[model samples]
Target: MVGLLPRFRRYRLVLLGLFLLLPLALLLGAGLGAYPIPPLTIPEILLRGEGVEYQVLTALRFPRVLGAALVGALLALAGAVLQGLFRNPLVDPGLIGVSSGAALGAALFIVLIPGAGALETYALPLSAFLGGLAATLFLWQIARTPWGVQVSVLLLAGIALNALVGAGIGLLTFLATEQELRSLTFWTLGGFSALTWPLLLVGLPLALLALALLLPLARPLNALALGEREAFHLGVHLEDLKRRSVVGSALGVGVAVALAGGVGFLGLVAPHLFRLLAGPDHRYLLPGSALLGAILAVSADLLARTLAAPAEVPVGVVTALLGGPFFLYLVLRYKREVYRA
Candidate 1:
């Protein structure tokens, strides 16, 4: 145990660093937009709350940055949980078709319900949450064999579901008015430009709740790394763990998708990067992934807004551009390992 102290201390330090870096990243993101508020002036502007800088930071950039961080953290947490539950590093929230399903739900709400009076406020998120849950249940049913959960089958089933959802979205787009089509197009591409405090007020609590639920499962996930039968023998309740993990992941990803649209690859990239840095211990991986994911999302949002100046790029485009090659590299390196597993 004494010999293990150094390693544990190192993990603590790394976590502390991540916790500290997150605020700095958020401040940088808030300051580095089209208006370009100086980092030093940000404090004054925030404190005084009477200037154009304050107005921009508070009314525009701050909410969007906060949303990005929350969405990123939730997505990464969902990915970490799903990967551990499935025992597959490649697994992400999107892999289960939840994101696509949520997209379809949002699309349906937008197209079919067009101008739904007061109910319009709740419609999109409710639709998305239901869609994600429905997808998860469907995936669970299709992938469960008499013997056990077949992970490969789940992956293939998810792919098929995503394709089906994509077709549905396409049909909706085809039928939609030009204005509605444009809204759908921007949403599918993903951005934080439309973020509002009301959405954040609802989403933050749910995402935090999901994160709290996942934290306790770290030890169970660690045991599962030894294989299901071994974990069962070691006194882990496999069914209970799976059930909670799936539901928790779905809840987190559903809220994230509903709030931020289909911001992809943060889930896949953040957890994998943290796994490389901090090893596969879920205790470290979960929080580390969350912090790193928040950083990535905020920084990416900054890039999305500033890189094109007047024409802001979609945050999803930035993430995909960065994560796509990394994902391909991971696939190439781990293909055999994943296949054998």
Candidate 2:
């Protein structure tokens, strides 16, 4: 109880920091762009909603930043739950083939549709969601045994699924026209370029749903971390937890891929960061990771937009550049701990 109190207090502080940090990131993302809007003038710009500044702030930056935060939160929220559910530090939503499936789906639409019009606005996201849902269901089926979902088998199956999805994407790429190939490449690489308010409508509700599904499972996930038998003994329905975690994760990743294209590693980076700060208590870890993920994503998008000035880099490329080293660090940290044990 004594040890618990200090950890609890630390959790509160970490959570508070994240909440405060998020608005700052949003402000920066909104303010720093080609036509920079001073933070102080942003309110005036938004309220007036008449000038170029107003249009840029209200119509462009607001939705893009907000969408980035939403998708980042979903990715991290799902990552924290999946990590705890599967009891693996390295597990990401992408590990289960959701991103690949979503990418392949987008590729198919880009290559096959052949016409760019209003239909694309709805069609691309729908196709991505269906593809992701299909992968999730297939993964769940193969991983389910008479006993329960087997973590090892799930991981193996996910790898195989990703490979197959990759092949499909490759085939689509081969068939794509020159212009289609550029669009497809950029889409797979990822950006918030397409995330206007209309698109956010499709994503926001789904992100909220993912949050509702995954965040509440924190306590159960914490118990499951003790071991499946221990968790069951403590009244955590191991099967249900596994099901929700996987489904919720796939849903969030699907929305992310649908809206932003293949934004990666916010999932893997955010949860591990929270663990480093406050230990692995999911009550804080899940939401904390989501908050931090939002901050990182907003910041990454900011850098993506500004670093190249008039030209923009893919947010996914930025995240991967940042996350790659951090991933290596996690592996090294894990190695040291294992050697010590």
Clashes of each: 0, 0
Clashing pairs in 2: none
Query: What value of lDDT does candidate 2 attain over all alpha carbons?
Result: 0.89
Name the lDDT of candidate 1.
Answer: 0.86
Minimum summed lDDT over a 10-residue window in model 2 is located at: 40-49
Residue range 222-292, candidate 1, lDDT tens digits:
99999998999999988788878877888889888888888999999999988777678888888888898
What shift in Å separates residue 296 of candidate 2 from its native position after superposition?
Answer: 0.8
What does candidate 1 score on TM?
0.92
lDDT top scorer: 2
